[model samples]
Structures are given as structure tokens and as C-alpha cells.
Target: MFLFKKNKDLLEQYTKYLELCAETLDIFRKAIAYSFENGLNEHFEVLAGKVHAMESDADDIRRQIERTMYEQSLLPESREDLLDIIERIDMVPNCADHLATLMTLQRTPINPALKSEIMELLDLAIESFKYTKEAAVDCFLKMEKVKGLKILIDNNESLGDKLEHKMIRTVFAENTGTGEKIIQKDMINQVGEICNLCEHVMDRIVICSIKRQL
Candidate 1:
């Protein structure tokens, strides 16, 4: 009875860990939008700071989850799966921080040739993470919903990839200075990578779901 109750408490902690992961992803999504929507001015720095803090807090929770799993002797399969999911989810915030830092250091105006294409990629990338959060929540709250959310995440990711390629081709075609072309390509790659990270995490979430069933 004591072991069962202890396991229950650990499970509750697991749920909280997932909540932090979701919150971090949402903050990352907003940070990306704010960077693009308002431009990287003073206000952007404030939003980025918030994201940084949240990511830090999420990291703490992730460590706590790890410790709890070990202390309580969680099943190895579920433990490993959950750890993988958390690690992948961490990439979302890491990407946001990297992108924010890059923009702060470089004040390159959005390229006219790829502005619309870039914004389209941002929307698709944000949606991908948005659905990623849902799929993660579904894994915890409604395991059966995981498969459907997985499909939507994949679709969003596919469209994001196409837009990324389109934006890149547009960037190279701009007939700009070589230095300028390189900077713009780097920016586009970072943005596209956020979407890619979402799909990567979703892959882990799907695996976790399968482990849950087994």
C-alpha cells in the first residue's frame, strides 16, 4: 500500500513536469511571434527575458522529474521514454533563446524578397509547436488522442518544411551582397529549425505513448 501511494505521488509529479514542458513551449511560440510581430526592439528583449526565465524553471522541473524517477524506481521503459520526451521538448526553448540572441546581436532588416515567405514559415512553425503541446497533453490526459494529434503535427511540419525551402530559395535569389545572403540564410535556418524541433519532440511523444500502452 505504501509503495502504491508513493508511486501515485510520483505520477502526480510527472504530470506537473509535463505542464512545465507545455508552458515552456508556449512561451517559446509567443517569443518567436513577438520577435517577428513587433521587431527586435527594447520590448522584444523583455519578452525574451521572460522566455529565458521560464525555460530555466522548466529545466529545474525536468531535473526534479529525473530525480523522482530514480528515487521511486519507475519502470525503466516509461522512465526512459519520458526522459527522451523532456529532452526533445527542451529543444523548443533552446531554439527560441538562440534565435532571440541572434536577432539581438544582428539588426538585419527583414529581406523584402522573403518577408511574406518568412512570416508564413513562422505561422506554420508556431502552429506545429501549438499542436505539439496538445499532443503531449493528450498523451497524459487522453492517450487515445495521441495518434490523431501526431497526424496533425506531421502535417503542420510538412507544410513548414515546404515554406522553409521556399524562403531559402527566395533568400539566395535576392541578388544581394554575399555577406547579406549568408546572414539571411542563417536566420531562415533558425526559424525553420524550431518547426523541425517540434516534430522531433513529437516523435518522442509518440514513442512515449507506445510505451505507455506496453
Candidate 2:
């Protein structure tokens, strides 16, 4: 009974970690929108700070859960699988924090013409995250739901890739300096990477679910 309680507590902490990831992504979305609307002003800086803070909080929870799992005495394979999933999920917020910190520090100039495409990409990335996050929760709560969610996550990643390519081509075609074109393209890639990372996480989620079933 005590071991069961420990395992259950670990699961609860894991759920909280996932919730933090959701909050972090929402803050990231707001920061991106604010930056687009206001051009990375003081208000945007505040939003970025919130994103970083929430991500740090999530990291703390992840570490706590990891330690709890180690102490719970679950099957080695099962424990390793859960730990791997948590590590992969951690990448989503880490990417968000990295991108937010980069924008805050570098202050890259976003070209007016690319604003629409960039916004669209950002929206798609967030959508992908929502589905992926849901699927992740379901992996532990309801294993059967994962396959369906994987499809939605994959679609978003595909759309993001096409849009990213179009934006990159458009960036270079503009009559700007080569250096600026490269920088803007990198920014677009960073945003699109969110979707890619989401898809990557879902792949592991699906595999883990399957392994559990077997």
C-alpha cells in the first residue's frame, strides 16, 4: 500500500508538470503575439519573463517527480519509459524558453512582409502543442486515445513545415541584405521547430503506450 501511494503521488506530480507545460506554452503564445503587435517592447519583456519563470517551475516539478519515480520501486522497464517520456516533454518548454530568451536578448527585427506568415506559423505551433499535450496526458490516463491524437499532431507539423518553407523563400526574395535574410529565416525556423518537437514527443508517447499494452 505504501509503494502504491508513492507511485500514485508520482503520477500526480507528473500531471502537474504537464499542466505547467500548458501554462508555459500559453505564455509563449501571448509573448509572440505581443511581440508581433508591439515589437518586443517592455510589456513583451514582462511576458517573456513569465514564460521563463513558469518553465523553471516546471523543471523543478520534473526533477521532483523523477526522484520519486526512482524511489517507488516500479518495474525497471516501466520506470525507464516514464522517465524518458518526461524528459522528452521537457524539451517543449525548454524550446519555448530558449526562443523567448533569444528574442529578448537579440531583438531581431521582424520584417513587416513576413508578419502574417510568422503569425500563422506560431498559431499552428501552439495548436500542435495543445494536441500533443492532451495526448501526453491521455498516455497515462487513457492509453487508447493516443493514436488519434497523433494524427492531429502530425497534420500540424506538416502544415508548419510547408509554411516555414514558403516564409523562408519569401524572406530571401525580399530586397534585404543577405545577413538580415539569414537571421529572419532562422527565427522562422525556430518557431516552426515547436511543431516539429511536438510531433517528436507524440511519437514517443505513442510508442510508449504501445509498449505498455504489449
Candidate 3:
């Protein structure tokens, strides 16, 4: 019974961890949008700081969850699977934090012309993370909605890839200087990487779901 209670508590921690990640991503979207519209300004820095703080909070919770699992003496395999899932989920925020840092530190100059496409890609990346979060939540809570989520995530990721390529091609085609073009391309790749990371985490979520069924 104590073990059961510990598992329940751990699951609750996981839920909180997921919530923090979602909040971090939300702040990231706002930060990027503000930067795009207003350029790197004071407000953008505040938002980026919030992203970093929330990511740190999520990491703390993950550590707590790990400690609880060990104390409860969960089977080694079960512990490993749970650890893997949480670690992957944590990366969502880590990626958001890294992207925010890249933009904030470098003050990467985004071409005005590419704003529309770049914002579109950002939307897709956030949406991908949303589905990834839901799928993960479903798995932990045994909500049985994991089915078909992988396909949805994959489809969005596919669209993101196409959009990324289109944007890069557009970047190179521009009459901008080579250095500017390279910076723009790097920015695009970082945003696209968020989408790719979502898909990668979803892959693990799906595998965990399958293992649960077995």
C-alpha cells in the first residue's frame, strides 16, 4: 500500500512536471513572437527568463520523482522506463530554453520578409509539443488515448520539415549577404529542431504505451 501511494505521488509529480513544460513552451512562443514583432527588447528578456526558471523548476520535480521511485523500490525495468519518459519530456523545456538563449544572447536578426513563414513554423512546433504532451499524459494516467497520436505528431513534423526546407530555400534565394543568410538559416533550423524534438519524444511515448499494453 505504501508503494502504491508512492507511485500515485510520483504520477502527480509527473503531471506537475508536464504542466511546467507546457508553461515554458507558452512563454517561449510569446518571447519569440515579441522578438519577431518588436525585435529583442526588455520584455523579451523577461519572458526568456521565465522560460529558464520554469525549466529549472521542472528539473527539480524530475529529481524528486526519481528519488521517490528509488525509495519505493520499483522494479528496475519499470524505473528505467519511467526515467526515460520523464527525461525525454524534460527536453521539450530544455529545447525551449536553449532556443530562447540562442535568440537572446545572439540577438539573431530575423528578416522581415520571412516573418510569416517563421511564425507558421513556430505555431507548428508548439502544436506538435501539445500533442506530445497529451500523449504523454495519456500514457501516465492510462487514459487510453495514445492510439493515433503518433500519426498526428508525425504528420505535423512532416509538414514542419517541408516548411523548414521552403524557408531555407527562400533564405538562400534572397539577395541578402551570405552571413545574414546563414544566420537566418540557423534560426530556422533551431525552431524546426523544436518540432523534430517533439516527434522524437513522441516516439518514446508511443513505445512506452506499447510496453504498458503488454
Against the true structure, whose lDDT is highest? 2
**Maximum-TM-score candidate:** 2
lDDT of 2 by residue, 56-109 (tens): 999999999878888766877777777887898898888888888888899874
What lDDT tens digits, residue by residue, belong to model 3 across residues 1-214? 1223347777788778888888888888888878878988888889989999999999999999889888887877677877898888887788889888887898875677778887898888888888888887777566467767888888989999999899999999988899989888988888888888888888887787777677
Ranking by lDDT: 2, 3, 1
Candidate 1: residue pairs that collide: none
TM-scores of all predicted structures: 0.81, 0.92, 0.91
Q: What is the C-alpha lDDT profile of model 1 across 30-146, one tens digit per residue?
A: 655665567778877777677678778877877887888788666676567667777887787777677766666686645656767777787777777777777765665447677
lDDT (C-alpha, whole model) for all candidates: 0.72, 0.84, 0.82
Q: Is candidate 2 or candidate 3 better by TM-score?
A: 2
RMSD per prediction, one decimal? 3.5, 2.5, 2.4
lDDT of 1 at 117: 76
Angstrom error at residue 62, model 1: 1.1
- Regions more than 4 Å wrong, model 3: 1-6
